[model samples]
Target: MTGRVRGALAAAAGALGFLTRVPVGRDGDAWAAFTAAPAAAVVPGYVVGALAAVVVAAPLAVASDLPVASVAFAYVLAVYALVGVNNLDGVADCGDAMVVHGDRDRRREVLADTTTGVGALAAVSLVVAGLALGAVAVAGTAPFVAVAVVLAAEVGARVGLAALAAFGSAPHDGLGSAITEGAGVGTAVLALALAGPAVAWPLLAAGSTLAGAASGAVAVAAAGAFAGALAGTAVVGAWATRRLGGPNGDVFGAATEVARVLGLHAGVLAWTLS
Candidate 1:
């Protein structure tokens, strides 16, 4: 393979290792490559989304009578199991920062504080509940539709992270800076391009499984969900930029969690309306 190809492969491996509990090996070289190629972050979304989709859909497929609630519970568990609670730490940190009535520096200090506050408790609770509720709605859909929605949401969440990395500047030297320092508009475009297949595959599946109108609705739902995820993350990024000076590792994590939940709801709502 060419040097570029090898570099891209290593970057992708690094992304998977850093982002998920998947057994990809990690190293200094891989981490450096991943930071340099921000687009590589989008690649892992497909793998993570697929695995999570299967976890959500497999039970329904095997036992058609399985309760939707049970499936939803599994979906939530599968997400945490795959991605771990590291990102959720961001949610807690950001949550604490959000409630602080102080200057940006004070909020930033709160972001770095290890002490758990009521804000953290509330934020984490809401996110977890939102995720579960969204999964319940998705689980109520047709199996193919459910799978498509789950996949789209997961992938969209990662796309949100890539967007922040590509477009936002870090306020300080940390994880956010490490990823965003080398990124720019080009990185954002490439990340979006990498995410296209995740969206397209769902539309194609919808077309195969439903009649024209229904398929079109699914198409809308999937697209809406993806867009919703990006939009949700954008809101978080903008808010963080204003409130905390710029995006940080905590902001990125919070964005991911928020985007996934919003995306899931947006897809379900679109499908319901259609």
Candidate 2:
């Protein structure tokens, strides 16, 4: 395949993995014989998420006889069915294990073992439902602002996952790191190179959403939440690298989900305040 075709193929596979339960193979080599551009491949996943939001949100905005608010909520309701819970699971696994109980060692163990704790269940279930409802409410009440809010959260989480994925292991390279390694430095540069300008318009629109918030409290809340979202992934990644000394595919998957859910809620709550 041509270079761009390879890239697009890689991106689409990663997106399929991101949005569904299917696994992203080592090196994302399912398509390529060897691992191919894992980190850069994540761009496709972000594209998919952004597309998913637009697909679900736009139609709901137009056709529903329900109040705009109700229509907004429906978008979130679809999200929970589509992509939200996956993140919630990651959050609960990270939370119940690391945030609530257990040291780094124990948390890693808990995270890996095929077992579920009450905390994990509660955390994921609650966050999924709450975020969906909150998103719905925000979309209904706030409309364009809420769109920016969720989009930022979605885009931020995916990008954050790619950045964190760069730190991986040897024989056990991270799902992100391994697949990323396939793409090469030049590919990564190209992937991110166009991102800034592409999102410029959205950023402007997002800025408009945050404009009225003009409050220190709202800023603090949003900032704090954004920090919190990163903590879950960074902490887990660090712990895996430091203690266990490497990140596994599960950890990578866990990080992606955790980051996405946390960003959504944090954005929603922050926007709600203003």
Cα-based lDDT for every prediction: 0.85, 0.52
What TM-score, over all chains together, does every model reach?
0.95, 0.64
Per-model C-alpha RMSD: 1.7, 5.9
lDDT of 1 at 262: 93
Q: Where is the poorest 10-residue window by lDDT in model 1?
A: 204-213
Against the correct fold, how does model 2 do in TM-score?
A: 0.64
Please give the distance, in angstroms, between residue 144's alpha carbon in candidate 1 and its true position after superposition. 1.0
What is candidate 1's lDDT per residue for 113-207, written digit by digit as tens? 99999999999999999999999998887666676677788788888888899879899999999999988889888888888877776566554
Error of 2 at 99 (Å): 6.3
Off by over 4 Å in 1: 205-207, 210-213
lDDT of 2 by residue, 130-243 (tens): 556645544543333444445545554554455554555522444445554554455435444533432343333343434344333333333433444455567657866765
Clashes of 2: 10
Give candidate 2 misplaced runs (Cα > 4 Å): 18-35, 41-47, 55-73, 84-89, 99-105, 168-194, 203-246, 265-274
**Cα misplacement distance, residue 216 of candidate 1 (Å):** 2.3
Model 1 C-alpha RMSD to native = 1.7
